[model samples]
Target chain A: MASYTERQAGSRLADYLSERAQVLSIALFFAICILFFSATTTTFLTTGNLLNVVRQAAPILIVAVAMTLVITTAGIDLSVGSLVALINALAAILMAAGLPWPVVVVLMLVAGGLIGGVQGWFISYQGIPAFIVTLAGLSILRGFALLLTEGYSIPIRDAAGFFWLGRGEVLGFPVPALLAILVAILGFIVMLHTQYGRQVVAVGSNMEAARRVGMPAKRVLASVYVVSGVASAIAGMLIAARLGSGSSNAAQGFELQVIAAVVLGGTSLMGGRASMTGTVLGTMTIAVIGNGLILMHISPFFTQIVTGTIILVAIWMNTRLFDRNWRFARRKPS
Target chain B: MMAAEAQATRGRGDAPLPPEPILRLRNIHKSFGSHEALRGVDLDIRPGECLGLIGDNAAGKSTLSKVISGTYIPDVGEIELNGRAVRFSTPSEARDLNIEMVYQDLSLCDHVDVVGNLFLGRELKRGPFLDQKRMLAQAETMLAALEIRIPRLTAKVEKLSGGQRQAIAIARAASFEPKILLMDEPTSALAVAEVEAVLGLINRVKARGVAVVLVTHRMQDLFRVCDRVAVMYEGTKVAERAIGETDLQELVDLIVGKGGH
Candidate 1:
């Protein structure tokens, strides 16, 4: 006998739209930013300027991709900026000490993973809140960089291979931009198709359930930090390569910008939801806004104010407006 | 009623003579600090039988089920599976032995799709990647076998109603071909039709020769699906009776500790 339930099947289209509502809204906002910038600024849409925006946004994109995984587990990594500065200084220092560029790169990535592993240990095994652990990491890491550099920028000379990583052009595109795109694509694939990605979402959605089902819940939680650490290390190396110098003051408040990009991309702060495509678009939107404002001759300080305002409004729209029975253009009665 | 009773008796007679239980628990005693949650309880579950576990709140009904499911380790107990003694330190170990429990929370991931949740921890993989195509195909067969209609497998669990969600949870547990399936209040949140569907699912699983433990406060369900009923009182099993030999009033009396003598 058939069941007498009142709830009937909804259309597949409605379900898809509901599931991807956040991503769609963020895409719309990003497009609006692009249109506004292209209309207002003379060189905003130029290929060269667009390339430059992506080139500069490359490091942020890499770190933001890893941060997406971290945040998807309902965890935050505030120490990412400080970790970048540390690795930047360390890579430059190691390179200046006559170590081969390749060796230095390997060492920095390992160091990043180790540092993240330690933080993850405290957060996962020790039951420390991720926010608190990363907040402390933000302080200790920056302190280490400050102490190492003694408040001075260290110049990196004679690293031709390293410089190419940040400055070289490939097929008319900046190498860093290409690399960031590759990383974004990898992030998208991993989050959607990999077992590791499913585990991450499961842990975020219901940690106890994941554990009950025999998933290595704590290890998954801890490993995400390691990923963020390695990504930050790579970003740090990229910055050092680009500038030919490493400074203790590099990437100040960089974590905020990266996080803003992620949250604005519709990755839920509460965890269990993430969008790699949205993160990519969110990063570009921020970059374009910063570039366009400067081109419009607005003071850089005012740009910060505007960026902060936009981030606030975008997130406000994300949590408040999008969550409350809002659907994009309801289907009319036939 | 006579024909139904004759059929149940014939089914019992057709089973292995003096049938060995698929699962056996002896003197299961558990304590949480000063509180004694279970006091030397014993139970034997045979294949193709639904054992209804019922009692008032804090009567150790849930605690006994948890002990069996390995969610809680009893301080002292002897457990055997098909004549082999076994000890479980974790729920996973019990799961490895083909023992599955549908927890009170249902334990479905709100963010993941129906297919993902169905294969939650035991996902199929191909070289570090989820084998999505194969998993989708297998999930189709699994749901089809259980007579579950999800409408869209890609839809997240949170979007489904309580009835559909309950069915999915049961479908997940039953699809694993478990020998012992423990359901803790599976229909406490469902409407009448949904309750009927879950009861039907229980009958189907029972027909498959799996040892079913249905824990609930809904006494009416026991007559429909349970071959026998066990009553718990204050951390101990107070009574067990064949479904045909008992009535709702007797079960209520046993649970309330007033009339069964």
Candidate 2:
């Protein structure tokens, strides 16, 4: 009887490393950044500074978590930044109009979802490329924000409860930071343990295969955008609450930072592979770099150059050195 | 002989018999714009039987299989499953009726792990979460039942070899306990020993009384596992023969449109 010879299982340690190559590399890079910053600046390692970093990274982290889902489905939402600006502007306008803060928050979230749904419909049902649809959204949404605010920042007043969401501390941790952490944990659970997460990966990996196997592929594709939109709304609200005002210019170039953070975390732009842990690390690393550069007495404008370089290098190593197929040593034939 | 009687009654308006066909296709016709992919094809699939479908490229073998699997709706035809006429508008409808197809490309998500792919669309979930522990245990048994050995069930599909991937695809389809399983060139990418394993797997599946339609160019494989064979030429079934009644030369001629029809 003809039989298939079973391949000998390789070393367990090797298998573990290869599978986690991207996450490990990013984590290592994150550690190195932390070490460099601490050694160079006496104040960089302080709890106050570290907490401040997380607090500042909060909005970007929130949106990056959602962007992870978007990228996992092989889709990108270029409109997130614009959507954030629009929501940010709208929240202040609504509050100034004397609408209750809670009601405004809910309305903004719903508005965000509706806007995202429209874009998702075009991409999924209408068969338009997400890049085109979201690009158009980026322009149109930001334009709407500019039109609404008339190129001016709107001040929010008498909304202490709403402000608390952004500025309050819980158990000695910043509220925004805690919320960001909670969002990250939820995103991680959804991506790893939930049926919806499986559907996203499956649809991203092979739409036809997922469809053949009776998955709601188009629906899954569309839902990720809605997720991104909602996350952006939250981030927008938090920003408004933090500074006690909103502007059409809020979160400018925010989409790039969110995308950079997601990609930096080892989520493939091609889709079907995602790591929430990597995204968290990636977001924190960027935040730390931006923060650490100032402490080192470096010019603030130079931060962009450094951030861009790190993105390029990290992705370079992601594709080359730490590929899932890369092995530390060759296995000898038994 | 039993094969002679079965052949004599085929396409002659049903035979009164002890073993009724599980699936019956009558006058199936499909077209793609200016191309007629399938023209008036009739076939029957009996339970516990393996039917070999052989033809050259563009011979409508794939189209016919797709029709059976509900990937494409036939322009005109009748599909009878368990004596009830049915029309399938989508693959899921056919899957709901326990019809499964393993395509030539294997149709697996490379980014998903082995256990996940095995239960791709029909995931075993508990309260909105994928029941990973349960799925892993079941996936292990599923592979073990097919005598397939994978180093780890958690390994991503992309990490697997061609033969291993093929085995996983076949395992995914067969383990689903479908009433009818259609395979399109499943063994084409497999190694020689892996081919044997697939053939052995087919026999095991056939023993479970599932109707299997295997479309392949491997003539020798037909003799090994198929109880009967059908030949197609230019979108029409030209001939059908029981395993004992046909030779490799006859099948080759039939596929190439050389034998006297």
Candidate 3:
């Protein structure tokens, strides 16, 4: 009879820590930011200021949820900012042309899906790199927005129902903030519980294996972009409703902000891993840093430089310090 | 062991058995552009037995296994499963028929946990949820049945040792109640002790009456678990022998293209 040696078992607690290390570090970083901001500025911890921060960050948070899905598939959509600008301008133009507000919303959503579908088809079916295709889309869509509006802002007037989506209140909470929270919660549930979420992770983790196991790999890959597009459209509409105007310049460089939030939330750019809770915290952290610096009497322009620097340092820490495999003390006996 | 083999043979019938294979391939041909990978190959796998498929590098062993597993569509051939001709258009089709292949690379997802990878494509879900609690309990049972003792089912596949990962992959295939299991180079990277565990696992699977096709460069492994050996050279099967009728030297000579002394 052949006898086999049993593998020595390691502690489960260490394994849990290693797996959640990135999320934990980000959470700690977020808590530290909150504490620092509260100490530096008296107004930072106030409910009014916090609500305002959530209201303003709502658009980025909405799109960041979708971008989390995109990045998890090892793909990027550089065209998101441009898509937002286009939808923003188009929503105003259509509403000004006497189109009903609800109809315009539907039209904008469909437009987003169509644009995303076209880009997705090229990337997934035509085998063009997502970076290259979306990079081209960034230029083309922005150009279309600029040409359509001729680089002008259009005012949206007398649509109180439309305005409520962005600026209205519900139980003292900003409606946009509430919507963003809902989106994040929905994203978290889908990533954790749904079959579609599993498929997305599986496709990201191992495309060949997913395909071999009979997943609709290409379709799933393309659909993530469509989700992104629809998300951008919603964010674009929200921005227009809040400002009561649409401009070709709306959401310029917004894609970078969304990507920053998602990556900061601990979603890997290398694909196959994601964290919705991390993303929610990351969005708030950035929003707080931006808002807090202004409250501290720092130059608003200077806040941009600080935000950029913080992103670089934080991501550096995330990849180098947290992700590496290193034991913290000996494994505790179970 | 000999008495067990006799019981298996007698269970089928006292009548002369023609050894109807669970999986049969005849005149299988495959080509990669200008390169001929498999040339006029014929192979058979009987129930309750191990077929050791050994050959030199590029001898079409991998390609032949792929054909049976539906990873490759043969240019011209006949594949009979359970004495009936069947053609598989995709790997999933073969999987549906309980033909499982453990690829040389293992094909387990690194980001997923052991439980998740075990039920990778076919997950157990309840009302759109993963039913993780159920899966966890079942995964414990699955590993226990295989005598594979991984301390944590929640541990990611990447966190595991190579042997443990290999064991999980085999356990996954075996749990599916596969009629035919094809493993390619499963123990090639394992340590001496790990190899023994895998060989032990093979015997356990074999005792369940599943037809197994093991393709390996490890000749010594053949004598350990294989009931029969098939030798291949340059895309053609050169020799087939029952384990009792041949020795390692003769099989090695046949693989190296030598006439026996």
Among these predictions, the greatest lDDT belongs to 2
**TM-score computed on alpha carbons, candidate 3:** 0.91
The alpha-carbon interface RMSD of model 3 comes to 1.4
lDDT of residue B85 for candidate 2: 99
TM-score of each: 0.93, 0.93, 0.91
Worst 10 residues of 3 chain A by lDDT: A323-332
Q: Which stretches of model 2 miss by more than 4 angstroms?
A: A1-8, A320-334, B1-18
**For candidate 2, lDDT tens digit of each residue in A1-48?**
999785777998987988887788789989999999999999999999
Shift of residue B103 alpha carbon in model 1, Å:
1.4
Better of 1 and 3 by DockQ: 1
Classify candidate 3 by CAPRI docking class: medium
Which TM-score does chain B of candidate 2 obtain? 0.92
Q: Whose TM-score is higher: candidate 1's or candidate 3's? A: 1
Residues B1-261, model 3: lDDT tens digits: 454355345544532464678888999999999999999999989987889999889999999998998889999999999989999988889999999988887888777789988887888999978888898999999888767778789877877888898888877877888889899998877778668877877887887888899999887788778878898899989899876567778888988889342
Ordered list by DockQ, greatest first = 2, 1, 3
Worst 10 residues of 3 chain B by lDDT: B7-16
lDDT of 1 by residue, B1-261 (tens): 554476457656766363578999999999999999999999999888889999999999888888888888889989999999999877788988999988888888888989999999999999888998898899999888766677888877887888778878888888898999999999988878678878888888888888999999988788788888999999999999887777788899999999555
